[model samples]
Target: MKTLTVFTPTYNRAYCLEKCYHSLVRQDNEDFIWLIIDDGSTDNTKELVNQWKQEKKIDIKYHWQENQGMHGAHNTAYKLIETELNVCIDSDDYMADGAVERILSYWKKYGNENVSGIAALDATIEHQIIGSKFPEKLNRATLFDLYNKYGVTGDKKLVYRTELTKLYPYPIFQDEKYVGLAYKYYMLDKQYEMLLMNEVLCHVEYLPDGSSLNMYNQYLKNPKGFSFYRKELMKLPFGGKVFKYKQAIHYVSSNLLMKNPKLFIETPKKALTVLAFPLGFLLYVFIIKKTRTEVN
Candidate 1:
């Protein structure tokens, strides 16, 4: 059986896909399979992947499907992966040298039914850590602890057991959503803990065109998505003080600030900063406009 399955979900990213493929080709470990979920790209992405497959540089599996956004592609990848461990490498991002070998080694040493997955360091340009640090020793980490205490940020550098991952489907959204099915792993903190590998596994490039970079601006414009996210977050088994704190912040910034500015005028937080930081509501509108122009 394949020990690891690395998949990339991409759309119109043919230009950057080769970088990811090269990273995998250079891996010290070859005990993995590569799967590409092409989300209906008009670009010659299929041809590019085919060339690599024909060369036999790596075992490759390709699936092309109708465009249904990132969540849709992830759902397909989760269903089709047959390896013991699965990790997602974005089309625009690539792994550090020997990252796959290290992951497989850690899995062989520590991975078990009690462990839900593994987390690693994600770095950005100039070698700055963009996301949470992997703890040196394994410990029970709650989703709240993962976010609030450790400051879990980006989505790269996560590997999960194939069986546990297939249980949750990505949530459907009417608008652009911030968190995808990835939150399901956090929800599993109710039952299991993730192993931490203290190494930089992947480098995440922040493009002006990436989905997450502009999401805050969208959140400012359509606070309804924030309401939707909070509602879904409340449904998790770990819903409590920490969740409420984060949800309240999300609600106040998204719904109360933009959707109902009048409420802020009627009743404000006791702390002035709380009321001030969404930028007095008017400034947020200006910021959103500025971001739209810049990102677009």
Candidate 2:
């Protein structure tokens, strides 16, 4: 089996997906499989991928399913991955030069049962790091500490054990399509720490249509998904009261957006939920106003 499975979950992104494909073809190392999860594209994405498959320049696996949003596509990827390790490279993103070789080499040296996998850097198309690099002396840490305790910022690339990624399949809400992808990472944080690599693994471009760029709109459209994510975060064992309180604020707002009556009752931290009510209500009103203004 290949050492890594690099999966991309794509919707109607065929226009930009070719950039990701060419980058994979240029890899200095060919010891990885490219899995494309086609999330119900009305475009010519299937034909595009079929041409790439015929080239045989690299191994490719493709699966097409009805549009279930990003998190649902992730659910399918985790289920289908047969490799020991897996990393998600977004449709509009591509691996950095020599990234495949770097990852396999690093894991060969440091991987063991004690850890889950590696957390590496991500960069912009202009070759700038998205956030601060890992602390020079730091070796391993859970994804949570890399932000909360260490003062690290911005999005980082995560390579996780396929077995672990499969453990927390994201829940699918009937009409809602947005769920914070960090839900699974935080769950893994409870069980294992990951080896940190400062090397850039992927280059990301946040398109206008991408979820990261349109979060307020996502909040308005996917209240149940957001509410469920916030509630899960509040239950993490390692997160402190302050962290839980912050989650409560978002939780309250999401519930309000959905008009759920049991906000306080459903909250994992009831007192914090009560304390967070004022701000949460304000937040709900602000989101409503913000999206409304955009619409007009």
Report per-prediction Cα RMSD to one decimal: 4.8, 0.7
What digit string (tens of lDDT, one per residue) describes model 2 on residues 1-296?
89899999999999999999999999999999999999999999999999999999999999999999999999999999999999999999999989999999999999988898999999999999997998999999999999999989999999998989999889999988878999999999998999999999999999989999889999999999999999999899987988888898999999999999998899888988999999999999999999999899
Tens digits of lDDT, candidate 1, 156-270:
4778888988876766555543344546665677678778776888878977767777766656544654555554564566656555545545545555535565544433232
> How accurate locally is residue 228 in candidate 1, as Cα lDDT from 0 to 100?
51
Best by TM-score: 2
User: Best lDDT goes to which candidate?
Assistant: 2
lDDT on C-alpha atoms for all candidate structures = 0.73, 0.94
Query: How does residue 177 of candidate 1 score in lDDT?
Result: 36
